[model samples]
Target: MPFTPITAEQRFVLDHVVRVRELAATERFAAASDDVIDAVLEGVGAFAAGEWAPLLRAGDTVGARWTPEGVRMPDGYAEAYHDYVDGGWGTIGVPEAHGGQGLPFAIQTAVLDTLGTANMAFALCPTLTVGAIEALAHHGSAEQQRLYLPHLATGAWTGTMNLTEPQAGSDVGALRTTATPLGDGTWRIKGTKIFISFGDHDMAENIVHLVLARTPDAPVGTKGISLFLVPKFRLDEDGRPGAANDVRVVSIEHKMGLHASPTCVLSFGDHDDCVGELIGPEHGGMRAMFTMMNNARLNVGLQGVQAAEAATQAAVAYALERVQSARAGGTSRDAVRIVEHPDVRRMLMRMKAQTQAARALVYYAAGQVDRAGSGDARARGRLELVTPLAKAHGTDLGNEVASLGIQVHGGMGYIEETGAAQFFRDVRITSIYEGTNGIQAADLVGRKLALGREASGGGVFAELIADMRDEAQDARLIALIDACEATGQALADASTDDRLAASYPFLTMVSVATCGWLMERQGRAATDDAPFMRMKRACVRFYLEQIVPEALGLVAAAQAPADVLYAVEAELFAE
Candidate 1:
């Protein structure tokens, strides 16, 4: 099957759902005129489809190989990456001052959406680098920015966020990575960071690691943690990658998918000389790291969109070509394309609708980021509220759609040769990383909900519901919005145990309603009734009629008492 960049879909989302024109209207993003935006979408789409798509099969099969020297990427990856850099794809969202195109973040996300759909494992390299650029742009000292931001913004050097340790999986407070201040401005970073993606790759000349560590006199927990800029190679006076830093790839994880992305166990200062500069103030690591993490979270959500898009494309192509049985109710007895069958049609429609919904959700969030960057306080709060939804539910949709893609393929999907299974394996990690989807749910109820309240009198969540109410005319969407409101209010008064228990379901209800709202808006925008518009209208109809109603059942789950969840004794679970 062939993989084409969802260029038309992305353009539609940007034009209608995300409204990139509004971003262009802002003085900061004035350069992102319609012409420039379209060119970017078309150019990146062509580059991704022509350059990266070819590497997808080999990325899964050959993967990235590791040795003492470094992790060698799949063949043609270096050349493709060079072209990616040379083509200026990585510079879309970076600031003009940093040698970039200075476009809206949503446009950059569009680039990743296309490329990741082509080759997700390969796309992870630039994803983390974008996060690093953001972190440095926000928190790094002026000298640090001058020294590093240019190379990073240009994609000459890649970046990695090193937060995970063997024991500190989700608990950042438990990390034991130590950063001792030298008499000079730098510090010695020592500890092992596990599951560092693109931690050591040959794609760039140097890797800038944003590491989280604690100082000698710092307090315990995340409050005491600090962020460090630890590069693979120390820069000389001229700011080029000079001597090798003490960071070493202990080994890369042999994972279920994304094999081409080397998930590394990195040993920093193994010989006791890894040098790093403090990114922000002492004991401000968590705050600084969040700058990077927040950026990555949205990109991770986009990864979900990427996977969904890829899987949907493959499954749809497969459904149209594979002959199976006659239609459920048809005149001919002869076998027809599987797509003619009602059940397969159902599966294909679900995949397409869900993929579009997820893409809209992510693009909407990216639009909020751009607005927030342009000094929209309301958009900032909205961005905060929607980030988790986009990260968790978007990825959740990815997993669900990928699984459905496999089901649509029947048994051929079970075998690796058909290439349907790779989407599932690669996307499975999206829900688990950046912060597990469960953790994202917890953050939604525990933090974002309250923050939204503080930021606005009724809070951003309420504002979202209000926006949906204003935009939506469908009764199903309206009903879901009402249910979301009820659950949100109830959870606000609930106990910690209750809140956590209902968090996942509540997140789902809110996500589906929000996506449904966006889908309705997209439906309204497609009034011309062209073939694409008709299909858009159809998918929106299916989503509201079939998918939106599913959220109704979750209302009970979202309001379920926590006692039932804890009723059974934990010790007897093994029985």
Candidate 2:
């Protein structure tokens, strides 16, 4: 099945669940009228479905290759990227002062969903660029912004975040990359950054690399790190890309999936003289990088949602066409479509409900970002609280749904030709990158919940639980909310090690309960007697009765003692 943009579903979530209209009422997004939003959705949907979707299979099959010149993309990718740039799709949420459309991030989130569903590998390039745009717009000096923002916003120049090295995967403080000051207000950046996506791609004129490195006399850990704006090509007096910089793409990683995206190993200043300018205050790289990290994390969650959507579509399409077992009760001897079977139907419903639930949560979080843009402190806190859940649960759903997609195809799914396995392969990365799901769970329990009350005037988790309880009209939903509240309180009261042990299950419970809340709202708001609304009602019903109950077990698992996890001796497994 060709990729289709879920425009109606996106609009429904934006209007009913996310309340984008309320966001529009704010001064920051007041100019984003209904027509503007609709136009963007329609245009991007067409571009994604027509231009980008066709390249999906080719991208996976042909993939990207590293050459002596640069990282060469798959066939038709450069053309598609050019079309993306020409269409102005890259600038939806960027500020107008930087030659962008200046729309709300909620709208941008919807656009990203469409793009990601069409082709995740292609979508990743823009994803990193958006993060870099956020970092520069928030922390870059005026001169730096003037020099970089326009092309970046316009997609003429792409960007990459360089924080990880061979030794520093998640523990960024352990990185050994270095930067030395030059007398001309520039620094020479010397380091090897691994897993740098789009690090040396040929689609754009210049690649703006935001690097994290420590100064010579700086302290030993992350506190000593500083951010640098190092372009692939140095700028001339006219501010255009001029000479080649000292950044080299040593090689690209051959990954399990998203092969078309070049995950490069970058070497900077191997012979010295890689000029870079400081982004923010010295020794404050982590603070500035968080701006990008936060943006990318939510976008990664949306990647999960998109992959699930794509997988579900393919599975349903296959189930309808592939004839298999006979009808359970009928007299007919002919084999019926597998979709008619009870188990297949159950699997399909599970896929649909989980995907919709993830979509609602992510869109709601995006709406909170828009509110935060308007200086709403509570909304900001709410966003921070939900970020981990959105990242962890959403990707988990992606993996689950994709696996189900393969099962729906039965024997054919195991073969690469069926296309069902591709989703499973592609979605596996969403949980690992942008910080692993385990890291996200830890952040939720150890950091967010621990300090949420002091930062936001009230506990974020507590406030969300209360909101869910208030909105939950069904008894089951209310019960689920209560369970989530109790688990959250336990996390609050538990010791650090206990909280860490419980973090994963607690995060899962939060995601399920929150989805139940949003689904209930979606059900209430969907009043039409149309088929789509009927499907919405059925999906929400299945989610509440069949899916939400998983939270009960998660709650129990979350409160288990930490000692249980480490009780076994390390060498005993070998025996």
Candidate 3:
């Protein structure tokens, strides 16, 4: 099945669900008119389908190869990347001063969804660059910005984030990478970083690595960490690539999926000459890195939405064409399309409903991000409340939907040739990277819900629940809203350890309920004349009746005592 961009669904969410035009009314994004936004969606959708989608299978089959020279991408990848730069798709949301279009982040996310759906491996490169752009724009010094932002924003050069190491995976404080002050406005960085995506690629003129390392005499743990800008090549007086830096790609990891993406182990200052410049204040690296992490987290969530959408599209197409047994009630002896089968229809409906719900959740978060940029306190609070749920639940939804897509294809899906299995393999990592779904759940329960000034006295979730209640026009929606409100209060009152014990379930409960709210709103706004609207109505109904009810059980599981979770002794595994 050929990949389609689902621009109609995207436009519906932007217009009715996310209300993106409200962002256009702001002075910061006033130039992003309706016409410009639509044109951008159309252009990027075409490019993704025509130029990038063709590379999806080849990328998986050929993968990226590592030579002594560097990492070489699969065929047509370089050309596609160059076309991406030439088309100006990478800089739609970057600031105008950085040689970009200065559009809203919502538009950028919409494009990301299209590109990610078309080709996730290729899309990973630009996703990292966008995160790097966000970090630099927020924390870089004037000289640093002047030297790097233009090329990075224009996609002439690419960027990577380096944080994980052999000794430190999620525990950043355990990293052994060190940065020694050069005493001349630079530092000598030396250490090994692992799992660096797009770490070494031949797709650009240069690569800028945003690295986290510790300075001598710095305090222990994450507090001691500092961020540095380590380029693959040393810059000349003219500010272009000149000589090789001390960084080397030791090896790239062979992963379960995303074969085309080079996950490299990078050794910095192996030759004792790798120089780096501080990105922000010394010992403030964690703070600065969060800017990039937060950006990446949201994009990761969108990747989930994209994966679900892609899988659903493939499964639906396959179901309609793959003739099987005769329809259950039909008099004809001839076989009917599998789509007419009740089980297949149920699976497709689940896939479609879940994908649409996740998309709406992600787009709503994007809208809040745009508002947060304009210094809306409430929007910022809502963003903080939703980020964890969006990241964890959205990716979880992706894995679920992809698995269902596989089931919809039966034995054919298990075969790699059908491309259904590829979606399942590729989307599995979305739950693991950019902070695991487990970490996301912990963040939601531990930090985000803690009552404090930063949380605006813990009213953000409460306010959102109130909004859901007010928006509920249908009886089913109102019942769901009431259940959500009760669950929210229970979660708020739970002890920290108790919350952590049930964190995953709690996150699921919140996510399902939030999606129900959005889908209800979408149902109300949908016009009934078109087939698309009728499909939307059916999806909404399926979601509410078959899916949203799961929240009730999740809420009960989330409030269960922590002791029960630990009742199973460790020795039981020995048997």
Candidate 4:
């Protein structure tokens, strides 16, 4: 059912702007010579429209079934897995030397967008696999690399990060998993890991778990944690599967959404000798693990993109199909479609603008990821600054877009059969899971801001603002750039005193303000590009005018001490 009224702005972003191939012509953006992104997208579209899309409802309705053996995923997931792996979709971003296609994350992001949109449950497995591969590729030993990389790269085996415990949650320092050194170079791991994705599955022959545990007599707190590569099945010298290791899937989480994803609770060394190889050096697991976590966060950000785009698509379809009563300007005899209503237009427009802007941000960041390898260290640091922002903000945008999607449907949205409610439930966890939005804000202020503080000798986030301003292409983009500067300046001024706590609201405002600002930049860059470029420019205008205005209040709130948020008695409102 389509909306009764559709605004011109909403039409542009929702109906006109194409998928991930928008900036595929950008040379540095393409990881593969062929249209790998389009190819994957095409496959995803076919699968989604046919086999996979049908599962979306089943996933939400039926969810996953838990049994003594493990969580039984929806039917046909293994068959889907065979196609996904055999098609090379799983290894798009892995290095070519390790038997992967070594595609750029941008291309992979597009593919992922399709996969998640098709059936989010199915996407979680490979997303976690890519994260584990990232950790191993960066920190694994040569022997470890030779043993695991090929299989990981080829999608012949899957991987998991054994992080959370029953009591640990997001705090890694509280984990009590122990890794005892054996006489040989191997180690025996013993402990339980909760919420592990694809923890135990017959999808693949082996599962490589990058586990964090402590050595005996090690220093207390996070400093003592070490990362180990513990496999569900040990690999032989030739990298093939050897003996089954001592790991068992005790149970799986019965989550509200992503039902196809098996959230497993794994018990390691329930026997006595679970052999595991160490990744990187001892007591340095935190650093190595962060590599995976950060990469995973970025992937999580793209999952937001997936949700936003999918929701946008669904909203547009609903708006066009649903024929409601006449608009205020029209009589019942001359009844207009609900898309003709102004308020409906406003909601859809904001949704379209924000979603497209997020896509542009992540796409550019994807380019930056490629440039980081070939560019200077400063170039690399700049990429690092955008990483958290993209991950944090992109996912936030997902929820916002999905919410708007629900709003567009109104009464019908509340109905479970409409599927609008499902989108809302699925995207809700993005912000909380990958280190809460609060955590992302603190990292930006502490780590990235600390770097800016040292370099400028005083001003924080100023260089970025200045660089953005200078890149402005037209009068409007420049004006919006100035507004972001004012926002950034307010944040800088608020942080003048060394004892001051930086307001997260300020960080959030500037983050959105910058996103609005960059959308304009992207629009301007597309001057010579395509209809997609025109769509981008139009959305940029919408973001600058509609989205950034919301920042005014947040900037005002940033003037206050951060302790105010902390001081609030959260428990008082619990009831």
Candidate 5:
């Protein structure tokens, strides 16, 4: 099946659930007028479905090839990438001062969501480049920004984030990559970094690597770490690709999915000459890397939305066409399409509801990003509190929806020939890469829940719950809100062990409540009885009637103490 962009649905969510017009009211995003927004939605939707969708199967089957010289992308991958760059799709979110359109970040999120739906592996290239653009725009020296931002913004050169070494995955403080300052104002970066996405490929002229490393005399742990700009090709005096920078792709991983994107193991300064430039102040790598990681976490969440959208489309199409058993309560005894079956309808409705809900949640987070860009300090606080929810819940929905898609397909979904399984395999990494969903849940309880605490003992999380209660008063949502407040207070007062034990369920409760509120907004705004509106109302009703009520069940788990988990003796578990 050719992938189709859910352009109309995206526009509806933007107009109703998140309200992108509010962003247009501000000076920073005034250029994002309705006309521009519509053109972008229609134009990028066409570009993605036409240019990128054709490569989906080939990207998975042929994958990227590795040689000692470098990594070679699958056939047509380079042409497709250049087509994306030439069409200016990559410039939507970058600042106009850096040769971009300077639209709201939410718009960029929409663009990536559409593109990733078409071809997810291919979309990873630009996703990382966008993160690079953000980090450089904020922390790079004027010279660094002037030299790199334009190319990165235009996709002339790509970028990568190299933080995961073999020994340091989540425990980033354990990294041993070293950066030694050279007298000529450059640093020599030496170490092997693993799991570098888009580390090297034939698509771009150069790859700019943002590396995290420690100085020789720096302190231990993350406090000693610093960020560096280590390009695959050093820039010439005129600031174009010049000498080779001694960063070699040791090998690319043979992964279960995302084959088109080269997950490279990179060896820097193997020949004793990897030149790098400092990004921010010395020993401030975590802060700088967090800028990139935060952007990536949201985009990763969008990937979940992407997978859900694609899987939902495929499942719905198949269900409508494939004939199965006779309708359960119909007059005709003859076989009917599986979609007519009540059980299959239930699965399909669940998939659609989850997809829309996740999209709204992610887009709302993006809107917060735009508000933060407009210098709303409270918006920043709200964004931080919602980030983990959006990241963890969105991806969790993706996995769940894709699994349900397979179930809807019966025997066909398990086979790769139908392409249904690919959605699950490709999306499986999103929840893992940008901080595991488990880690995101922990962050929600550990850090974000207490953000911006006022003297009144309420903070950003409390404020958000209040807003939700004010906006949505449905009984299902109110129950969730009450549970969320009660559990949040309990976690706040609980011990460290208890908090960690309750984190995952608490994250789920808050996420469902948030989505329930957005779904209600969407349901209310969908007033007409047209086909789209009818289906919209039906999905909303299903979500509220079926899905939202489940959050109440999780309340018990959310408040369960740590003793239940620790009661199992660790040594006895092996028995």
Candidate 6:
């Protein structure tokens, strides 16, 4: 029931996507090669094993406590945070100017999985900090960056994205928090933002809130929304904490999981004389915030993979040690461990394969981000196109793999103490937060595929299909390729009409297809001696038999006409 490290299967799939090695003698990764990435992977694995692994049960058992000033974290949470920061794990992906290691995004993702798997609640504090750095880098004024970036990158003060209100979940257009712009540069903001992470805490001196509120004279809906930098404690020119900012943690939520992470009900403008400054241009806040959104979505996908990987390894270990029923050909006198049975072996195999496939897909997306943002034009174009798919598909892989992990544990999974339930609960939020799977799929259909269609999209997909065909010499890879082709065709056949109704199911098929495709590629690309290659082959076979059938139905449903979505018989239920 304990969380574990990357399985053989995960390493194999991700290997296809990332080039791992130790860092070179040279200090920087800008001119550095795979060695930097390799050392990063090793460092992450070591950190998870040595530090974070032992904290899983403790994090859950002693979740954060609420007090009059703010919520207090676990006993050793602060020390752990310091370890991660002092070790430079927190700033690996950011630029050098902001105290970041400034390594490749792919390497950063590889390391993030380790932290997430160790303790999602504890991992979250810094995860949000990284996102804040990304946002501030993109939108913060020069002065703001100088004041905040250094502190945030060093984890001196954490940051939170305040976009969600009670009335405004997905619909930012409905946001009503008013940012009253003063005659001077600053403004007095007043509104409540719920579900704000690290909103009020003693963990750091100041909290830089990237709050979303409407300007008084602004237009209604999303157009009126703007980004404001409201610190928990105002900073002086030397960057020391000064007067208190208006934002406060009125109360924290008692949630299903990640209890260690205080989900605060934050009051932004409750106090008059609450000082705030605009991040980017007025009313352009939503546009600027997307930097964080895109980054967050990718991290969430990694979380999905991390949870599944940890759960998969734990389940396998449990199956290895825990004695259960007798083997198929064995007598009642000799009961075998769960690992000895085909069905149990099959379950373990499924978990391993899915986790690996997901890891590969998420890592692949990280590579694309580097390429897309790089100076290379082709890399940029291809990355923009694949971003949504990576986020959506990776998350789907996470959920499916975690579900298998739970099922593998049988009754033990249903119990909270076993820890599989925590993974299940934590993973649920991946698809919900960082933009729902539906939103991700919509992004794929509306942005990636649509743009692909316009900009030689057919050729892009054709090349993808052709790549599989090119590698069709291998029998196992061929079968995976075929399954992927089937799923992709079904997805291509979908339109906006029925999508609203069957969106979840339809996107589920796409995710399966995408991961299956990657599995095939990883298998084709792997060496015979690699355990991951063998794991990929096993998952490819299992997915073909079990998960592919679901895709068939999803495809059939996606093939339905748009109007059919509303053809439901609600009256039948009433009767």
Q: For each candidate, what is the lDDT?
A: 0.93, 0.90, 0.90, 0.72, 0.92, 0.72
lDDT of 4 by residue, 1-575 (tens): 11111122222222122222433444544555444544655665665556556667776777667777556666766677777777777777777777777666656666666677666666777888888888888888887777788888767788888889999988989999999999789999999999887787667878889999999988988999999999888877766788978888888887766666777889999997788988999999999998888777877787787778777778878887778777877655566666788888887778878777776666556655655654545556666777778778888889999899999989888898898877778878888776877678767755665565666663445666677677655454455456556655555545443213553665566567567666665565556556656666677778777777676556455566666656668896676
The RMSD (Cα, Å) of candidate 3 is: 1.4
Per lDDT, what order, best first? 1, 5, 2, 3, 6, 4
Supply the TM-score for candidate 1: 0.99
Per-residue lDDT of candidate 2, residues 133-252 (tens digit): 999999999999999999999899999999999999999999999999998889999999999988988799999999999998898888999999999999999999999999999999
Cand. 4 TM to true fold: 0.88
lDDT of 2: 0.90
Which tens-of-lDDT digit does each residue in 286-395 have in candidate 1? 89889899999999999999999899999989988898877769999899999998888898899999999999999999999999988899999999999999999999
lDDT of 6: 0.72
What's the true lDDT of residue 531 in model 6?
61
TM-score of every model? 0.99, 0.98, 0.98, 0.88, 0.99, 0.90
Residues 332-393, candidate 6: write the lDDT tens digits: 65888888888888778777776766777677777666655555555555565555666776
RMSD of each: 0.9, 1.2, 1.4, 4.5, 0.9, 3.3
For candidate 4, give the lDDT of residue 463: 67
Q: Give the TM-score of candidate 3.
A: 0.98
Model 4 residue 231 lDDT score: 87
